[model samples]
Target: MASRSKLNQICQFCRCTPRTELKKCHKCGSVSYCSHACQREDLTNHQRACRVAREGVIIPPLDFLKTRKEKERLTEILTHCVPRLLTALYNDLARWMEAKSSALLERCINDLKLRYTPSACETHVLRVVVSRDEMWPSSTSTPGELFTVTKFQVMDVQYARESMVLWKDCMRELEIQRREAKANGLGMIAVVGIECPALATVRLLQFTGVGRYLLVTPAESGQRSHRRARR
Candidate 1:
């Protein structure tokens, strides 16, 4: 066996003391820290680097994609293709049994139906439907018909096990749908919208294989309260 000294050291950020116990960063095994507090403090500086490390390559967001055509293209891609890719990646990470496919899909569908509206202190949920033309040929009879619908829900906390489970289920469905679409020559895309803490968003991104994620804040008017606190 290799000597302990020869092994890669823990990140200074996660490690309490580099001279002794070495705890690596859970997100990116790169930078070392001594404690959660240190890791949180270093996050402001590590955000950009951590993103690059996780993605393997930096993709600068497109400024021009604001146009109608770009929007449509994006919608198609997300609704039709992204989900499957995420599912495949998630499967590779956790060798979950394929037998749970039906149950997983049903659970996702039910979750979509729950339809929790966003209110003060509550996360918002939205569903984006991809049109038929965007779906792979096998699933498309009419090009402009509904192809697939993606559901998104936001939460305030950081890395809740329940939230992670939901994300995993969504990813699995996306993967299955994408594969089915491809086999039948149909396009697959997915879109998600959520209102949650930035840290929670980052955790979600790292856990899920979705490459495109947008963090939106509630409007200022919604944030302000003309009336005094009730309590």
Candidate 2:
């Protein structure tokens, strides 16, 4: 049993059990890494949890939104797209953070402001919708009419301070649904990437354990949560 458990065990960052000893984080004691390199590699994802745990802050797990079947469907759709989605987010951030020209900075800020509109939850999320062209037209299709239900996966883009209200409002709405979030064809899954643009810093938020639940659609409200993607 001991050997079997070890075989199944993996590092929190690299997800591989190296030949070297695995070390549990001294502060949080919840994460284990196979090496210093692995720990450093995971710092972007683990920083918030480590600090919260060390400071004794208790964060409630965001409520689950979908039934097992629906969740499985959401997972199936997202499984293939997460990498590209994350890369897009990183690229978007890099373009902003590394901008040296006023024109470029202004353009990035305006674009991001539109993307992160506080009133539109969908705007805050980086989305991947199934291509309508790839979708076969139904009998009722008009020349330019769009489909009512779109298949998509969205990841939240978070900033600091004032955005906390937006995060809470999103949570309250989802919580009222009692965990039965709606599902369209593919349903939604939560992925979050945090940035403090003022500070020019970004952390790749990786949801682990129950921390995965946050903003979702109404048939979808519930799952991966929104928080201060702080500096």
Candidate 3:
């Protein structure tokens, strides 16, 4: 057994002595981190090992997640499309979308503005709903007791373009709300959804204890998660 003085107590990420006790990796049990933040910062690298070891199935590296190349069309929408929509919320494009869908985008932006930083509201406020069925991804589509019984149809965007128009309107509307909010208090931002292949990485193996759940869809995988996703 190693002597107490000779024990390996260094943090894996910063390589500095942890202010508090270092926490061991729950999955691998071979590494330690100072905090969840350090573990998160090193996750991209860690996942390369952890995912495969945890899940027996080999996963290809995600190209989109790797390249993350700028979408030209998305940039085009920010530059030109949004302002046009703001001029008339009930214009031709709005006519194409269901009223509830448009309102949902606007409402989410408004709610986020209450929490998001001013700078984040300006930049991150423009978000697109990637999840199907609803903007917020849910695990089981089956109605829970908490699910509201409403007569209205839940809107899902079939094409990225369908969400884009409302996203644009919501983006511009947030700006307007921001200006008006300075006179009151609330201000913040999401409305940029784009079309890209839904590529993902596989990280499971029977040898490793990682694949606690199957990564079938965004709802089943990481989209709705908070802590698991931060890793």
Candidate 4:
């Protein structure tokens, strides 16, 4: 761990701390930035440690992929693909905000910090389909997709117990569809919800030519929301 004086030193990107109030990186709870622009500038370099810190708290499910080969592929994505995607996503987010996405992300991180543990906040379900290219792939093209995602968030806040119920519902629905698709030789769909302290992303993935589908739900049960002391 860095010394207090080191963390208190000017922005992580540039030495501007003495001139301004510094804010710590909420995700890692380490390193401080004097401004959003400095945070954005330092993001690329900061992410290596940022990801390490986040993963230290929440290990990504690398074993979610069924086969050894699939697991390896997923590992490759987590190692190479995810960082690039996150960079782009963060950059886009930065463009939209007056204070930039880092500030927004900090607020979100703090909002869920006490109430949600990383482990409790993530869920993924997988099913096998017959054909890969047969289903509608886009969430926009598919009706009720947004509504379903929104409803999941609402459930997290309101009917927290129903979070598992919803997951089971999605699982059962996928199973039924998988069986039908297998009989007809068709493709499957998956919903993945990952709510990172730094960024919350719910993705609906459709493989163009694969049989496996995964669903990740964004709901964390109320039971788990009870705060756990940091080890």
Q: Distance from true position, residue 90, model 4, in Å?
A: 37
Candidate 1 runs further than 4 Å off: 1-17, 59-231
Q: Whose TM-score is higher: candidate 1's or candidate 4's?
A: 4
Where does model 3 exceed 4 Å of error? 1-7, 56-231
lDDT of 1 by residue, 1-231 (tens): 857654556455543336755556677777766567787888867766777788775534545687978867876776678767655433322222133222232232234332232121112123222222322223223222222323334332223224554444544554465567557854322223221221122111111211111122224222322121222
Candidate number with greatest TM-score: 4
Q: Write the per-residue lDDT of candidate 4 for residues 1-231, one digit (tens) a residue.
A: 878776577677887646556888988977888888888898977776787787763336554567889877877877788778667544433333322222222233333332243322122222111111322223232221211111123124223224543344444554465567657865432222222223443222222212211121224322223232121
Candidate order, TM-score descending = 4, 3, 2, 1
Per-prediction TM-score to the true structure, in the order listed: 0.22, 0.23, 0.23, 0.25
Candidate 4 lands at a TM-score of: 0.25
Better of 1 and 3 by TM-score: 3
RMSD of 1: 22.5
RMSD in order of candidates? 22.5, 22.4, 22.9, 22.7
lDDT of 4 at 27: 88
- Shift in Å, residue 68, candidate 1: 24
Query: 12, model 2: CA deviation in Å?
Result: 0.9
Better of 1 and 4 by lDDT: 4
List ranges where model 4 is wrong by over 4 Å: 1-7, 57-231
lDDT per residue as tens, model 3, 29-111? 76788889999998877775775676653545453543344445554565577656434322322222332333334343344
